[model samples]
Target chain A: MPGWLLWLTGYLVVRVRCAAPERFLNLALAQGLYFWDARWMGEEWLEIRIRAGDFRRLRPAARQARARVRIRRRVGLPFWWRALRRRPGLLWGVVSVVAAVYVWSCFVWSVEVAAPEGWQRLGPGDILAWAEENSLRPPVLRANLDANRLAEKLMLDRQELAWAGIRLAGTRVIIEVVERRFPDTATSTGPAHLVAERDAVVEEVTVIAGQARVKPGDTVRRGQILIAGIMLPEEGDQAQPGQGFSRPRLVSARGRVWGRVWYEAVGQAPLVEEERVPTGNQVREIKVIVAGREINVKPLRGIPYASFQEERWWWAWPVWRGFSLPLAVEAGTYREVEVRRHGRSLEQALDAARARVTAYLRVQIPAPAEILEEQVQVLPATPGQVRVRVTWQVRQNIATVFPLK
Target chain B: MAQGEKSSGGSKLRRVESSLVELLDLPADVVFDLPRLTVIGNRRVVVQNHRGIVAYTPRQVRVGATGGEVEITGEELQLEAILSEEVVVRGRIARINLRLT
Candidate 1:
């Protein structure tokens, strides 16, 4: 608004030389003109301000009053226009920059969706598909956008999402989401029996919400009930207690049943083998490409070494200030070129075979299993092969839910 | 009546008009057409409802007022602004004199 005053009024400083400059000032004031910041310049000269528009009107009065007016300085918008006219290139640059910013703001440049921690079900692809389907894709105009309404609509459609928010930051549309949590454990809903999943001897059984049918020393097979879903009725008739026609009530069952289990593995390793290792010598080849035109800068037509491990590497195109060209470069290298034969004694090979067998058995056991016993033995096998057999006894949870019929 | 008698009667009427202005709480400059001078800290002087300037110099300035000429003597005297009805002086003011002209 202050600039509006400067531009609309178009102020300038004038130096006036006259016998009575006050007479010229009073005449201007009488015509509803304004001036300020006047300074005396010795003799009959004085410096004062007047509007550029009123300068022409002042000339007549100045002539009549015998006052000489000379423009000392021009300011404000008119001055800026004259200055810009002298340098056309600078004026064009300024105008182009303003226009470019305007055009850039009209389109949505990027759609960014950040994933929440521990939320693997809702992926970036899923959010993008949903956003595109909902008309929130890139190249969208920011004007007439209702962010809150879009967020509410997204939340209403996505059952897994507990919260959804849309933010327009610069040229990017950012969607922040929070997913609903899935329960780690399920609750018993109806009457059911805790059945054994595998054949094993019961180690320890703890009843939490149902009747226990198996003791610590009892042996159970797969599909056998470990905890009962039915309990004895308190008011049962004594005569009908052992009858075949009596019906039993059912209830939801929950309990923990630990049992003893065993696993075995066999492995073999040869006494002699070959290993390829790095010889600390490598050849690198590079290529360059700009705007889809590729230049071949290969060091050689093919790998010269008799035996070499080749590795491929690629560099992507460069992008700056939202401008990119379809250009990329790929490079390759040949390394780890030496191969040697290594030999091991029978004891070392047997140790390696035993380690392999142990590792195989350890993978079969659960992380919470407690190993109660372990056994190993050397086996007779073909020539140049070390055969090993390993066995383990572990205590594990074997209880599984089974609804009563 | 003679011209001198008529001028005497005009003076008597002007005196009555000056008294009427005070009684009505009106500005004497508006009622009697007198120039108004305002000074601030001996550094600047503003004259409102002024007539014209008689003489101008660096150390002294003479501005025309109603029925008199006002003179200001100062160091580095500068006329700040000159409008039809107002004149402003800026500098270190030393002395001010009013002489009927």
Candidate 2:
């Protein structure tokens, strides 16, 4: 018989001791009893196995053969069931553990959101928040989730997402997303003109598919069309066949226009600067911040110096890379300093103000624009401040496509 | 005189039955109610159509068959299973003896 069937039916090993154990075996066989693995253990003792139900039948045969039968071991389901019944707590523990594992497997444990490569605007947290709103959050029952429907809804709700795939792997829910691809230029191919993005003096105009509106040395204002999409018939052209004078044709304007643009900025600095020079005496204090409130480890007395500067360094608990808990330890250092007023010469003040203006201009100018001319002017100084203004003339492409409504 | 006549008649009947079995190409063990022993590489033995186990020991095992007893002598011989019609013995079998009683 199969081992599993034997286990299910249950069996017992019995040791029979008698002067003639063979007689006991014959008597058991005669009684229609089934047994196996009968081995002689020396000194009139024999060990054999019989089904749990047939164990009692061996008693009559043992009596007829004058043998003493004692159960050596119990094997299979009946003994296990009896043992489990005797200890209700252990049985309950085993049952509860199995049930807990089954229940836990029914819910999602983790949620992962995967985005397209090089996509930076959308993050996993944003997708998770959106999923939470859609009832696809973690710890949700897997039975209630429809992967196809959820994926369809995600793509429909998020315009940037071109495709979405949601699947469950064990206890984790994985959401893969692809972002929509957009063309470099506007999708519309209708007639459009290249207009000046900002006010500039036109230096060169090259038209590829439209009529040139402005020539070299022409001054143009913002929104003025550099190349016109609508082209009229040339003066020498004549009507053909029955057609009247050729009508104007519309085409998408494409070309580059180089212009000289001017950029200007102004900066001011105080003539007499107030400076702080450290006095070398400093004190340190430690503080702990829970949530948004801080508690000092030791109370600090009144300030020792009238003029002082305090710098604090905070060490927060890092729960994850690039993320931290609100709890933190703050170390503050206070250095005593003396405030003094420093008088600057007129040339020095002008230089300081000019430096500030140059820094401001660097941020305003585009990288590819060539600087043709730069002029800095020192405005009339106010009573306690120096004022300077800087201007830059740069050559760059100033054309931008403006679709015709 | 009656006993002699009966013995002779039984021998004639046996001869006829054996001839009939041979003529039909029937299995002798099934037709003649004989024991069939299957030995596997001197490691295991299966006895079919056996009466019962007569004795069992680590070095020897005796099983009763239809008309004789099968004696198995080996080292650490074990009765793996025993049923009404089959008995399986497993061990390093050294010898087997079939004795008619």
Candidate 3:
């Protein structure tokens, strides 16, 4: 028989001590009792393994053969189960652990949010807070959550999101978001004039349905009209200077005009600045946290630094992706630091201020605009401070429609 | 004179039966009440159509057959399994002998 079958049915190792052990074995075999691994331990002693159920039948054979059969060891599953029955506490402990793990698996342990590239208006924290308000928080039962319906509701509520997808992965919830894209150009239906959006030197003009007021190389103010909605008659079509044959026609103006625009920004930096320098003295504390209660793992006195910077790391017991145990380890490190004034040269301060101005100007430029030239100027400022002004010249569309009253 | 005739007739019948078995191309062990022993590279021996275990020891094992006993002599011989009709012995088999009644 296979070893597994033997274990399942249980077996016993028996020692037969008699003058004629062969007679005993033959008698047992005649009675249809299965035995295996028969060995001679001595001249008059024999060791044999028999199925547990067949061991009881060996007594009559042993008596007839004038042999003594003593069980040397009890083996296999039945004996183990019998021992377990004697100690209920150990059995209950094993069962309790299995049940606890199964119960823990039925609830969500963590949640993750993924947003598309170039999207930052909504963060994971914001989405989690929204889910908390909607009763979809972590540690909730998996059966109670409807991922598809929740995703649909999220898309309906957040106008900025074009699409939302929620997925339940074991003990974790994953949410993916895509932001809505709006068209850049907006159209006006009524009659309007295309005017300069900012003060710039006109570079070129293409008129589609209007008369061009400014040409290339012309300087225009912010409100100056680049294309007029009213078009006068051609020179040949006019009757005379005082008496006009044809009247001016009013129509919506549609055109694109390019211009060179300049932007200026100011930045200041102090020559002497306060800096915090670490003294190389650091203290660390580690603790194990279970259910929000912490037990210190490292023995240490209270932190000694009056002025220190602290960095902390928390790690939870991760079972798998989207699954974790409630047990966590938290480690905190505190580094002592002292504040001191650092001095820099005037030239260095000026360079620092200029970098600040450049960074500020980058944010103000539009995506479609192309930078053509740059200029920087140092200005007089208060003592111990440097002030720098930066300018950028960019080429972009300057035409914006203004409705006619 | 009658006993001599009866012995001769019995011998003739036995010879006829053996001939018929050979002509029909049947296995001899099955046609006649016999035991078949399979030996595997001097490592183990399996006896089929066994009557019972006659004697067993670490170095030797004897199993009863239809008309004789099959004896196995080896070192550290073990009766891996035993039943009324089959017996399996595993060891470094040095010799095997069939003693007829």
Candidate 4:
């Protein structure tokens, strides 16, 4: 219907310049040559379109009419094929790119796992491995992915998850999950008392659902009850005149209490230190490993150092940004280092020992405790080793429930 | 007297054909060999059932028909197409005249 379709079918459009294009038209019509889109330019020149096969037949008629016929342009499949043959690389590149894009689009490329809030108790890798075993992994055909059914199946299979949803976004599969929140039944109905978990001087105590047994500035020991679960009728209440004496009520105590606590840790450092330092002498080699066979891509045969330590890293060969081949490259480097012993002053040894003690004490104290003060003392030790003990005083909230069995 | 009777018989034959055409409700153009001219807004003319183009030029085009010759005079007159049965004449048509041959 359009000229481009005619071009595909191999039609030729020629511009005929003649003294009498009208005679040519009449002659062509009488012979039934079937030409169309006849446009007349001034000064006996015109353009017309005809089938590619008809051009030879028109030549004979053109001789009789004495019209000058020249092919101004050549179009259609035959010409296109001729031009394509000249530059084979372009045609091959176009075909390869189209095929690569189509093949890549049909398979899954990436998988993303979203574990919200408290669901991170399990690592992402464990969930990803489970998904892979369940047939939800990269390189899976996109057409075979049933998102809704897979989500329902995953939720049913995992008892610890509250809900699971799988969404297909482009070539990436995104998995979202919510872990089930198990109820802590002890704090609600159990007969529990708020107790101090460490030796501390209580700075503040607020009892919400229990009788306050220890007040602010009160020195308390470990396992001492700060809030009582059992409420007894006091003498003051018994002295009041009432219609009847109410019995003692027991409750599950919940409260907040802040206390200052102390922690101590001991660490040691040597006066003379022996360390291995890199000597900047290294040999690097890159090799490609496919299956089990290895081929040296970048060989380094000269190893100047007799003794060295080697480090190796492997990476899969990248085909595109999001695509990779099965082949992997292993990079290994051998570095030569020298062992050196260095002497330090007594003050420097003491400072290093204190640093080590402080580092040890940090692990002993519970998190969320603000350090109020730290005191370090040099302990009696041998000549080579400098030993020190560190004491750290910190303020922390000490509110732990002790359920009475 | 024979020649006079023959001329009257020719007139009677023409009348009978006309009456038969009207009774049968046939198109007049089909019954009679006629050339149809379609003029579009003084810009183009399509001539159907034409014998051939007698003369063609940028100023005018003469098309031969059965009864007469159709003449088209205009500026930049182009013989767009010419089939065995039809010819498309395109230009700024200034005048159209049929000269009986």
How do all the candidates rank in terms of TM-score, highest first?
A: 2, 3, 1, 4
Pairs clashing in candidate 2? none
| Clash pairs (backbone) in predicted model 3 | none
Expressed as tens digits, the lDDT of each residue in A1-405 for candidate 1 is 255796665788889988777677656666667676666766567887777888888876688779989999898777888889999999999999999999998878899887565464577778788899988877898885677778898877765677888888768999888876643234458888888877889989999877788999999998899988896544555366556555566878788899997778999988885678778778878887776777878755777677788867777755789888787888888885677777899899988898878766665665578999988788998998889888788899878788776
Worst window of 10 by summed lDDT in candidate 4 chain A: A180-189
Q: Best candidate, DockQ-wise?
A: 3
**Per-residue accuracy of model 4 over A314-374 as CA lDDT, tens digit each:** 7877668887667988999999978788999888888988987776566555557899998
Worst 10-residue lDDT window, candidate 3 chain B? B25-34
DockQ, candidate 2, comes to: 0.44
Cα lDDT, all candidates:
0.79, 0.85, 0.86, 0.80
Cα deviation at A53, candidate 3, in Å, is 3.0
Prediction-by-prediction clash tally:
9, 0, 0, 0
Off by over 4 Å in 4: A1-5, A85-91, A110-137, A154-405, B1-21, B28-101
Q: Kindly provide the TM-score of model 2 when superposed on the true structure, using C-alpha atoms.
A: 0.51
Candidate 3 falls in which docking quality class?
medium
Say which prediction, candidate 1 or candidate 4, comes out ahead on DockQ.
Answer: 1
Top candidate by TM-score: 2
Q: In lDDT terms, which candidate is top?
A: 3
True contacts kept of each: 0.36, 0.75, 0.86, 0.23
Q: What is the lDDT of residue A132 in candidate 1?
A: 90
Q: Mark the regions of model 1 whose C-alpha exceeds 4 Å error after superposition.
A: A1-3, A17-34, A40-45, A56-69, A76-98, A111-135, A157-160, A169-405, B1-10, B22-27, B35-48, B52-101
Q: Local error of candidate 1 at A369, Å?
A: 22
| Candidate 1's DockQ | 0.18
Query: What docking grade does candidate 1 earn?
Result: incorrect
